[model samples]
Target chain A: MSLSISLAINGQPLDVALDDPRVTLLDLLRERLFLTGTKKGCDRGQCGACTVLVDGRRINSCLALAASLDRAEITTIEGLAEGETLHPVQAAFIAHDGFQCGYCTPGQIMSAVGLILEGHAGDDPERVRELMSGNICRCAAYKGITEAVLEAQKAIADKSGAEQNRRDAA
Target chain B: MNRFDYVRPASVAEAVAAGSEPGSAFLGAGTNLLDLMKVGVARPGRVIDVTRLPGLDRIEWLPDGGVRIGAMVRNSDLAYDERFSRSFPAVAEALLSGASAQLRNAATVGGNLMQHTRCAYFHDLASACNRRVPGSGCDALEGENRLHAVLGWSEHCIATHPSDFCVPLVALDAVVEVEGPHGAREIAIDRLHALPGATPEQETALAPGELIVALRLPADAAAFSRNARYLKLRERTSYAFAVVSAAAMLEVEGGTILRARVALGGVAAKPWRAPEAEAALEGAAPTAQAFAKAAGLALAEAQPSGDNAFKIELARRIVARALTLASEGTPAAMPALPASPFSTKIGANHVA
Candidate 1:
């Protein structure tokens, strides 16, 4: 049985047809939409290589069925940057050398962004490490990854705080 | 994964009716279901998506001052909920200790309770697993059975239930609410999961097509809400299944124990409640010596395999420590312990 789902992907409306109901959000994004920035490591939910933001919440895309996510807003790694300017998380990854092979970088960054937005990435580095344990970096680049997340969290917080202040002044 | 038909029902009645169809399974969060499907363990012909069912995502307070958590409530939301965290600290801590942020965000309370075992043999299709295929033969019995069960395990299957929330829920005396073709019914959380008797495939007591609605915690348990603790001893600090976890709740009055409840995870086929330990702790002084004696009684009948013999001692120690921490009103977090020589031998793979 085929089904049609309407959803917004990275701010763009997408109408997708699923011939098989078992198609995952990760499969649809990578194979159908050609958004390969979200890597698929384990197909199973055990690994967080396919982490994506659905309605501003980080979730394992590999476990989410496309049909079940109708009308949901999805943000992959490709959607992070605006125009040519890199997202603060992307810039922090480069600054901190958070990747040895770059395979798990997209997932790590998405998870970090979600963590910061969820108000979980506090000043404590240990808390950040605990919250980011979902995304695995097999290269053992945890030190760099942890540093990158901390830096990005502060940058994002500062920017949001400034925006709030500007609005308050207005 | 197998080709399947999907139906997203708008109402609880519609969902239950659709779920009553043969070879149809209700889909919630899909964390474990998708993984099992990919591995050829579950082959449902139709999936009834119940996530869209309205009124099933609420966390409301009952009239008795207890809480009713909907089955559709995400693990992350319930863990971070101020009311839930305040009233059920052990449950919240256990929820956080189980999965990572990403998985918790995607996982639902009902889905976590219905998750299958993580026994390597059970996941391997080629291997003989009684839990997977009844009477096929139990491979984990003699082969790499380090993560297998030690308590309440039968010769048919020795797999352990890998839910952190369930341990504390059982200890809290929670009840599960479900709806089906008949009507709505409530089952105690401890009775929801069945021991691996002769039939390992029948893990849960829920009849087929009975949809879990919510879990209700009684108001009488409020006294131990702040005094409860959940201690998980895994291979690493995070994102790992428990080797032996303990959930302890003590109701003390003037330095004397009024009541005690303890449940264990990663030690048996289901959440194993330590009735003997609870009985031993009643009316006793809240001391380390009393906790040690109760902990010993909890593991008195434990039967471990060759590779998992250490879990017996591990479970006992964790129960004692968890009780001590609960008595001291300390939040249950990961405990620091000396390195174990048996960790490597027990296959502590860094999968996550």
Candidate 2:
């Protein structure tokens, strides 16, 4: 039997054709849809390399079956940038030098984005470490990862304030 | 992996019927099942995904002030839910202690409860595992029993329940609600797992066609031990199996133990509740001597292996320390795995 699902990906409505029930959302992205930015260091959930957002929640795409996400909205690493400008989180990673080999960069960015959007990321390093402990880096760049998230927090705060001031003026 | 039929039922009845078939598995989180499938530990012909079932994704408060956690509720959501933190702090703490944020986001409550053992012998296809194949024999018996079970182990199997959530759930007296061909039936949390006495093949009590709907827990003052703590002694800090974990629920009324429930992890085949230890502490005054004695009673039945003799001693110290902290109304100072995890450093400042 075939299953059809309507998904909202990157703010665009998509009707994806999925054939294999065992093929995970990670497979659907890299193998089927050519959204190869989401790296698959480990197809298992241990490595947070396949991070993505489903209905605004961060998940390991490697662990998520595409067939189960019927009408959910998804956001991928490729979808982080709007038009040509990078999302604040992505830019923060770049500005803070969050990665060495950059294989884990996308997953890190996606996870950070989810944390920021969910309002779980705080100024405390331990909180960030505890929350971001799932994504493993081969280079062992946790200090950079923490700094990157902190830098993003600052950027997000600044942007919110600027927007609030604009609203006040209006 | 191999191809399989997938069904996402919007209701409980449809899921129960689909799951009761000959070769099908309930897919909640898909974190463990799908990974195990890829590695060939689990190979189901059909997967009935119950995540979309309308009523199964909620956390409803029972009229008695207890809560029924839906099977499909995500672990991340449960860990962060304000209501859970207010009523069941230990439950939320245990959930957060298990996996990372992203993994927890994908892991469902039911799947975490039903996770298979972390024994390497069981997972590797090449090895002879009683779990993977019924009569192939347990390779861990004669092999590396370091991380294997010492308590509640039989000749047929030696493995530990890997989930961090079940320990707190079991101590809280949770009830597992299931739906099958006959209808729905509620099971005590203690009965969900069976000792691997003769049949290591049968891990959980869920029958062929049964689907877990939700877990209902009763309010117990012991489970809300503000002094309650989750101690996971793993090889690494994050995303590792428990080496010798303990969940302590201690209650002291005027310096005497009114009630206390001590449960151990990574030492037994299931989320082991220590009745002998609990009995020992019932009337004893809350002190170091009493706590250590209770720990000794709890570990009296432990049958450790050559590689893990330290675990027994370490287990005693951990249990004692956890009890003492909980009794004194102090937050448990999370025990760190010895600086030399793979060595014989084997002491946590407090003598075992």
Best model per TM-score:
1
Fraction of native contacts under 8 Å reproduced by each candidate: 0.78, 0.70
Residue-level lDDT of model 1, residues B1-352, one tens digit each, is 8878888989888988888889998999999888888988889998999988999899999998999999999999998898787788888878988878999998999899888999889899999998899999888988999878999989899999999999989988899999998888999999999898899999999887899999999987777875888888888878888999998999999989999999899999899999999999999999999999999999999988648999999999999988987897844332211112122221232232
Candidate 2: Cα lDDT at B255: 70
Identify the runs in model 2 with alpha carbons over 4 angstroms from their true place.
Answer: B221-223, B328-352
Error of 1 at B342 (Å): 17
DockQ of every candidate structure:
0.59, 0.50
Candidate 1 accuracy as lDDT: 0.87
| Clashes found in each candidate (C-alpha, N, C closer than 3 A) | 0, 1
The lDDT of each candidate is: 0.87, 0.79
Q: What 10-residue stretch in candidate 1 chain B is worst by lDDT?
A: B336-345
TM-score per candidate, in order?
Answer: 0.95, 0.93
For residue B222, what is the lDDT in candidate 1? 75
lDDT of 2 by residue, A106-157 (tens): 9998999888777764565655765687888898888888888988888888
Which of the CAPRI classes, incorrect, acceptable, medium or high, describes model 2?
Answer: medium
